[model samples]
Target: MVKKDTALGTGTMADRITDDEFERRMYSHDIAPLPKEMEAIFNTMPDFVVRPKSAKEVSNIIHVAQRKKLPVIPRGGASWGLGGCIPVKGGILLDMSTMDNIIEIDGDNLTATVEAGITWKKLCDTLERKGYFLGAYPSSAPSATVAGWINTGGVGIGTYKYGGAGDMIRNMEVVLPNGDIINTGFDYVMPNGSGYNLNWLFVGSEGTLGVVTKVTFKIYPAPEKFESISYSFNNLKQVGAAIHDITRAPINPFHMGFGDAMHYEYLRKVGIKAPKVGSLLTVTFEGAKEIVKYEEKVVDSIIAKHGGKSLGTEVGAHEWSSRSYEFKVRKMGLGAIPGEILVPMNTFSKVLDDTAKLIKKMKLKVPMIGSVADRNSVMVMPYYLTDKRKFVRSLTTMGFNKKFADIAFKHNGRPVGLGLFFACNVEKMFGREGSNLMHEIKSAIDPNDIMNPGKLVRTTTGFGFDAPGFAMNMGLGLLASVRSLLPRDTFGEKK
Candidate 1:
């Protein structure tokens, strides 16, 4: 039973508290009403879902949680595909969507100051009307928030040209667990001091250190003209080579993505089809009209050299749009678990080939798609249909992830925070040292571990990986297998 929040209580978000008081504090956000399949994973149901309308309200909620030593999980749009946003400890679901307000647009500085709750789609819509744009467009754009995007280190369709979401942020305002509001660098917009960059610390911390109240991003001028094209290759090697060659060239495509032949066939089953080939590449570019035309010619030459058959301009754009939102479509049908992994440039071909082979070996049913980054390596999202073969697909998903991590690690590649199937297995994947570092950071900022505990970082078990709840549902025996595989002191000891 949750008790009422008495006193101002640390001056955070909500002035009042308790599960019974939820109806009054929270408004318009859905409860834990999740599908049966997801309930088992979420563990505990949040006692209340609070929809705060302002930063003060957010701070108040944090203060209340801190006073009560209760856990609070911040959620934006509630469109997170992974279990990251699910409140495993069951306390308060701080829905930030209500605070969706675009604070200001500084055209002179080429930046936009926005609240954490503002949706990316809404922001982009407003920017589009003004002939300006935020460079990154994660596939979740229709429902993903700008703050959520930054918090999770989002990689979008335009990442090939613009870089990751972290690269676009200039400064931000974060509220730490101690109820201290700190402005990182965005305060320097008016000029205070020019030493040390602290915004990056909170950007990818994934809401562990603090609750992000507002964000400032470096926006770019919208391209005057844009073109999308798709090409199909009879072989995976050719497709990989084509991606490498095209990206390595002078023309920088705004978006570049790839899908295996099986993936295209799966889309065809649902009345959507790319050019017939073993693998397909979809490239979209934006620039001045003449520049787009010239780039198109150059891209075509590279495709021809790699034995890629052009599917023309019309079909290509449609394909790119469809591919961009493919995950959403998959959700409505079979529902897919994404496997997002980044790799180094030189070994990209091998990674792609290895990923394809893993999917084949697992005999899982889903599309395996990838987006190239500067011809170095690709961020792969392999869709696994969870509805058909639940247990088998789940196990296969885990296996495929292990394959990706093992192979990528061997190739000197690192994971970009999260992945699809094993989204919450960062500690397991990275090992003890990495896990401890993440936990220590969380502890320093949130000593009581009141903010989204067990989501990104976990507490020390004091008894190795076999610690209580360490295995969760994976069982004690399987935990042994997993523990055996992790490198001891994973975060690394000096030298």
Candidate 2:
């Protein structure tokens, strides 16, 4: 159990590092809202919480942690839902958000060097004033840190065309697990010449490898005509065909995202103005005005070929503007847990159909949203509203996500992030040899297991017990079955 008094603050920690109970409590959780009953297993509170304004300070802390053999959890805005930043065992928590600063912006080179803690929204807004923008950013850009999104998958708007974080990073400044600083690529040149292409390794490493202090990312000039248009389909078949054909078409849009009618219904339930349609695809076109106009014609032809009607520029603009807060319905007074999976375009219709069925089978009313990532894959997100006040019953809803992953897996897809809860899938996500190699790499770099231990490399409770993968699956399955048998959750349902 964590300490309840102020004595933890009186330790030998540096003046900047604090053991204050109030601050530690605040930093313990990101936005997950995990139940108090969970305190029995995972200890969220840290023995120390420090905000380092520079990479050197970060190095010093990591050195201290290494000496003491304590786990070091480096964090940004702490906006992610998964227990990525949450501590399984008590250790030092490095809050990087306070270090947010724009280091440099080379307009001639079209790159921005920023401290890892800056929010995507802040950086985007600042760049807009100077007529520049990022190639891709997280959907939670307003609050998620640049490093946090890059640490995760780094797929969002502009990803369909401009690619993800791994593709955009020209150079990355990372403080390794052993307090050594290294640059993965050149600051002003393309990173292609190379040896391991180290930047890609850290992009999705999830802080298990090292702490990213600064990054120089490739940027783009703000488009001359950045516009979005939408089309409504009678059903999922037409929607799927429209997306599939659009991918095969001779044009490339900046972004593509869609939602079934039920998704909009949930949005309207929360009073967000959304198009009332069975299903619709919103496509964003960017470039010269004439180019955008011509591309719109091509997209319209494809939509018409698939039996879809245009929703016009107005609704499309609203949809594009509201992309970041797609799951705002969570504010309707219940715990909202989202499950995200990525699959090929061929399995798009099947996945949506199965998602609808799973929702019904689980007695859930929430809906699903999808976005095109590239030519090969598309991401789908499904959310469920749970009354956390019910405690055990609410915890059981996690089975829906596990079952959700099963559906994605069967369709040649996988879930997005593997923080604490989903760490068991490491071996399944990667092949046996690949998984073993990843563990070996983790062990090699962080020999003491101090860099975000009990995470992606493996699963361990605060009690030092490792959770078996099959056992986790069975437990989740049982919980899901138990949840299905309980009385239906009637929150936000129409009378």
Candidate 3:
């Protein structure tokens, strides 16, 4: 039994917010919906939704929730397909979109401060106008919010050189679980003091520890020259070798990504001349003219050594400029479910081969795409296009996604973001000792369990056999059974 009015309904915070604003917040709840078939696993919805335009308002809302012992689920742009922003326990959905604002651009310090809700693309455009740019941004930059990506463990566009969003953040203002506002970095007057890197603790915490209100990110001067190059490989092994050699070299490409045959087929449908037989690797460089020239020479040498054929700059330029087109194509179907796993550079080929085999065995239609995180690891993202409204197809997609995660785990890979979907796989990725340490930290900071409960760490009480992992496995088993019963070509051929 839960108290309605006292815990969630119009109470003290109602006095500060208008009814229209509250209703508006409730209307725009989530961007992505869980598979219709997995209702039993994740069907929780927030009781109240509140949009806070300032840190003080956020503090007030959180304070009331704390007093009432209610869960506080923070939300940004809601662009992520994962269940990171969903309210599992359903209490107050803190919509941070209203906090969108670019606070400052410290030219002398080469840093910019902006409200967390601001989109990465907006920030990039703002910086570009001033001859500056972000070090890295996710593929969803156009719609994903700064804090959302920071909290979700962002990795995409510029990871090859600049690393993930965590690497770009210099400082932040975070509102702790108890509504206390603290600056992760030094005070404005003394911005370079030595202290525990608290800024990073909240970076990938997924709002379980705190809500990031504002962020200060390191910025760099806009490059004077930019170039894109493409290469073709006869097989996954060749592509893997090329990536490994390029990543291990002294050259630092701005971005490096590869796609399997299925991905290129989709690209071909979109009027791009992607090779049909094997894999396509694209690399982009941005810097001084001399640096770009040197990096291109090095990349070409590595590709040649790996038995890769140069496709020149035309294909690479088109692909780089139209990177977002892939997402558009993904959505063209009923819906696309993406499974991302980060694996070591050496095992990239092995993982790809294993996943391809699974996809083939399951008769799943998914396109494999990946980007080199750095010299040591790569991020593999395979998207399954399915009609979520169709139970059998949706179940098949979900089951395949779980299998992909399992394969990644077996190959020393972990999920890029531990949203509700990947929460159960934490123990497998990080050993028992590491997982227990994380749980301990979560308990210490959010003892009340009012912050994003049921995510990162399970909060729902269950019997010994009803652990989250067991439940997920059971669901996967059910899905597999249903899929096996379905007729061949029931979901139709891969588009």
Model 1 sits at a Cα RMSD from the real structure of: 7.6
Q: Per-residue CA lDDT of candidate 2, range 1-495, in tens? A: 233233222333356677788988887877765777776888778888888878888887788778777788988877777778888887889888977899998999999999999999999998989999888887889999988988886678889998987888899899988999889898888888749888888987888999999999888889898999988997766888888988998888999988878778878889999889998799999988998998899999999999999989998999989988887888764657778888899998898888778777777676677789998798887777766677877888888888888888989998887787887677778878989999899989899889988887687788867788778778888888888887776767666
RMSD of each: 7.6, 2.5, 3.6
**In model 2, which residue pairs have backbone atoms overlapping below 3 Å?**
none
lDDT of 2: 0.83
User: TM per model?
Assistant: 0.82, 0.95, 0.89
Cα deviation of 158 in candidate 1 (Å)? Answer: 1.0
**331-408 in candidate 3: lDDT tens per residue?**
445666788888998888789789878776676777788888878888999987767677666766577667787887
Local accuracy by lDDT, each model: 0.66, 0.83, 0.76
What is the Cα-based TM-score of model 1?
A: 0.82
Give the Cα-based TM-score of candidate 2 against the true structure.
0.95
Off by over 4 Å in 3: 1-33, 37-43, 187-195, 267-277, 459-467, 477-485, 488-495
Question: How many clashes (backbone N, Cα, C below 3 Å) per candidate?
Answer: 13, 0, 0
